[model samples]
Target chain A: MEKRYLDYIDDVVSRIDTDSQTKNKIKQSLTEHIEALIEKHGSLAYNKLDPVEKVAWEFSENLQLQDRKEYSYPWPRRYPVWRRVSQKKIFNIPLYHITDGYNPETGEFEIARGIFAFGPVALGVFTAGGIALGVFSFAGISAGVLLALGGLSLSALASLGGAAVAGLFAAGGMAVSFGLSIGGFAVGHIAIGGEVFGEYIYKTTTGEGNAVEWFRNYLPYFVKFFQ
Target chain B: MITIEIRKELKSGVIELAILALLVRREMYGYELSQKILDLSSGQIEVKEGTLYPILYRLEERGIITSRWQAPLGRGKPRKYYYVTGKGRQYFAGYRKEWNVVVEFMCKILE
Candidate 1:
C-alpha cells in the first residue's frame, strides 16, 4: 500500500480570531450577488463590469445561458429543503424549515415553520429548537397540543420532561395532569409517584383517598363467594 | 482631497446609516439595497458589495430593522425582504442630526 502525499503542512491548532457569525451571511450574499449580476448582464457586457460583476460575467459567458435563471427565494436565497416540491392546487408548504443562524453558516434567521422544523426558534406540526411551539414540540421550553417533551413542557394530552403538565396524562420529575400521573412527584386524579396527591390516588405503597370505597364495594362480594 | 483609503473608511462609516435611511423609505432585499446605494451615490460610495449582509445582520440584532421572506408576485420561490423598524426610523432621524453636526464641525477645521 502506498501512502498518499499531502499538499499542505500539519493541521495547525490554537489559532485565535474573532469569527463573526456574519461570515456565513457574507458568503451567501457574495454567491447570490454574483449570480444576480450574471443574470442581469450577460457576458457581452463583461468589458463594462467591475468587482464581483467580472466573475459573474465570466460564468455567464462560460455557461452560455442566454438568460440568467432567477430563483424564487429572496435573500438568504437558498434553503435546505428535503425533497423537490411539487406544484399543487389545494395547499403549499415546505416539509422542513431549518436554519443555522448562530453557527456562522447560512447566516439567516426566521421563525422556522414547516411539517418538520429545526432552528434556533421553530414552529411546525413537529419542531425542535431552543424555544418551540407546535402540535408536537421538543425543545428547552416547549408547548404542544398533543405531546410536548422538553425541560419545561406543556400540552393538551401527554407531556413528559423535567417539569411537565398536561390536560390528560403527565409524567416527569414534577408532573401535573387531570387523568393519570406518574413521576417522582405526581399530581392527578389517579397518581403514582414518590410523593403523590390527587382526588383518588394510588401511591406506590397504598391507595390513599379512594382506597376505602374500592374495599367496601368489592370486598363483601368476594367474602360471600368464598363462604 | 480625500485619498482613496480615507474615502473608503468614510464611506464605510456612514454605510450603516445609509442602509437605515434607505430602508426607512421602503423595504428592499440585500442586493437591491446595495445597488440602490451605488446608483444614488453614482458609484462613489463603493464598499465591497458583499460586505453588506454582515452589516444588515448586525443591524437586525440591534432591533434597528427587521426581515421577512416573501415570494415575488406572491407566488413561486421565496425571497428575504428587509424593512426598517419603528426604532430604526427614530434612529436614523437622530443619527442624521448628529452627522450634520459632525460635518459642520469637520468643515470648520478641514476647510
Candidate 2:
C-alpha cells in the first residue's frame, strides 16, 4: 500500500534465488500481510506505528529473507548428531582391519571381519563402505554372492550400481553381465541401454530395435533363475 | 535472555509443529494465525508474518496444506485462507508424539 513498504518487499524478493512463479506468490502474500497490518493499525505511515508493531514487521521481513537463503542453500543446515557420526567397527571387532602398511600395530591393510564390516579391505555377511566383500555388499568397490549395489560392484548374481559386472542381471551406468544387463553402456546375453554391444541388444535412445522376441523367449528362464 | 542465534534455531525447529497443531482446529488466514499463536502461547511464542508465510509455502508445496482466496463481503482485498490437508493431520499426529517425548524428557532432566 505504501511506497516504503513496497520498496522493502522488492528488496527482499530480489535477494531470493527461487523461480519467478514462487517469487510472485511470495510477493503477493507479503503484500496482503502488510495490507492487513495497515488495516489493523489504521495508519498508512510505517513511522506512525507503535514501536512493538514496527519491530514485529522488521523482524518478520528480515527472518523470512534469512530463511529463504537457508532453504535455497541447505548444505549449511545443521544435521542431527547420529547422522554425522561415522563408525569403522561393530561390537568392538576389527571391522576396518588392515595389514601390510608402514605400521602393522595400527591395523593398516588388514582384512576386515564382522557381521557388517566397512573398510579399505573389508569382509562380512552384509558389508559396505570401501572395498567391501560380502553376501550382500555396498561400497565404492564391492563383490557379493547374491546382490551388490555400489559405485563399482562386481561378481554378483544381481548387481545394481555404477560400473557393475555380474553373473546374472546387472543395471548401472556401464554394465557387463552373462545374463540380462541394462545401462548406459551394456554388454550381456540380453543388453538393454543407450549404447549396447551384445547378441540381443535393445537401444532405447534411437527407439529403433526389436528385443521383444528375445525377451519373450528368455522370460521363463529369467523367472526360473530368480526362483 | 537467551541469545538470538539459539532463539532463531529453536523457533525454526518448532514453528512448523506449532503452526500445524494450531491449524488442526480450524482454517486461518496469515494475520489470524499469527495472532492465535500469540494468544495460545500467552505471548510466549510470536509467529512473525515473514517466517510464517515461507513455512506455509513449503507445507503447501509438500501437499500438507491447501489455500484458497476468500473475497471480503464489503470492499477490501481478498484474503488467502489456509487449511491443513489429511496428510498434514497424519504428519502432525506423529510429530506431536515425538514432540511429547522430547518435552517429557526435557522436563525429567530439568526436574
Candidate 3:
C-alpha cells in the first residue's frame, strides 16, 4: 500500500516535471502529504478491494474536497477611462466610462506555500543591505571603497536577477499548487519546513544570495581561521 | 420480492457500475450521463443533482476516470467530460460477468 501510494505520487510527479527546482519541492510536498494520509488512514484508502463491496461504502462515505480559494480580489475593471477636451475646464473634463462586473466577482488564484516563501528572504536581504550601507562607509581606506562598490554592485545584480528567478520559481510553484488544488487537497495546518526548503532552493539557484551556503561549501576551515 | 432495503443497495451499486460502463463506452458530460441513465432505465432511475458529483470525483480520485472542462462551440458554460481508463475497462468487464452470475443465481432462488 505504501509502495502504491509512492508509485501514485511518482506518477503524479512524472506528469509534472523533474528539471525544475520548485517542481522538485512541490513533488516532495505532495509525497509527504500522501505519506501522511496513508499513515493517518492506515492504508485502507488505497486497498485494492472488490469493486462491488467497495462502491456502497466508498461512494457515499468519502467526501469530495471543495475548491480552495487562495487569493481572491475584486474583478479588475477592463475598460480604460478617456477624457475629451472641452473649451471650458479642459483639464477636469470627464468623458467616458465602462463598467462590467461578471459572475465570480472574486478572482482567485491558488497560491503555493513555496511561492509565498520568498517574502521574508527578499525582505531580509534588502534590509541587511540598507543596514550595512548605513553603518559602514568609506572610513578612509582605498580597499574599503572597492569592497563597498563590489558589495553594492553584487546586491543590485542579485536583486534584478533574483526577481527574474523568483518569477520562474513562482510559476513552477503555482503550477504545482494549481495541480494539487485540482487533485483535491484539504489541510488543517502545514509546517514551516517546506516553505524554508522552497525559499532556499529558489534563492540559491536564482543567484539571489546565500552567504551561509557559500561559506560552508567554499570556506569550511575559515570559521576558526577568522579567530 | 426482495426487501426494499436490499433493493436500494443493489440499485445504488448497479447505478454506479452503469455510470462507469457508460463512460467506458464513450466520454460523457454530467447532464449526458444523467440523461443516458434515465433513458437506459426507461425513466425508473432518476439521480439527484447533488449526488452525482461525489461519485464522479471518487471515480476520478481512483484514477479510473478523468474529467476535462471545455467550453462548447460558441459561448456557453464549460462542461466536464469524463473518459474511462484502461483499468476502468478491465474492472467493469469483470464486474459485468459477476453481475450476470448473481442475476442467474437469484433467478434460480426465486423460482
Q: What are the C-alpha RMSDs, in order, of all predicted structures? A: 16.5, 20.1, 24.9
lDDT of 1 by residue, A1-227 (tens): 01110100000000101123332344455444544554566553333334344333322222222122222223332212211111222235567766433221222345676777777677778888888889999989988999999999999999999999999989999899997777889998766677888875555554344523443575555323222
Model 1 over residues B1-111: C-alpha lDDT tens digits? Answer: 221322435644588888888899899987788779777877655434434665677788899899997767843345568998999888888999999999899999998
The model with the greatest TM-score is 2
Residue pairs in collision within model 2: A97-A110, A98-A108, A98-A109, A98-A110, A99-A108, A99-A109, A99-A110
TM per candidate, chain B: 0.82, 0.87, 0.84
> Individual DockQ of the candidates?
0.10, 0.20, 0.05
Q: Is candidate 1 or candidate 3 better by DockQ?
A: 1
Cα deviation of B63, candidate 1, in Å: 1.0
Judged by DockQ, which candidate is best?
2
What local distance difference test score does each model get? 0.62, 0.70, 0.38
Could you tell me which 10 consecutive residues in candidate 3 chain B have the lowest summed lDDT? B1-10
Across residues A67-108, which tens digit of lDDT does each residue of candidate 2 receive?
A: 443454324532110111123556765444332111112212
In candidate 3, what are the lDDT values of residues A1-227, reduced to their tens digit? 35766665444433321123433543444443344344445657565222322332232222211111112324333211111111232234212111121111123321111111111111111112121221111111101111212122122111111111111111111111111110011111110112223222213233332333534576567334222
Cα deviation at A54, candidate 3, in Å, is 24
C-alpha TM-score for every candidate: 0.38, 0.46, 0.33
- After the best TM-score superposition of candidate 1, give how far the Cα of residue A65 lies from its true spot, in angstroms: 37
Candidate 2: C-alpha RMSD to true structure equals 20.1
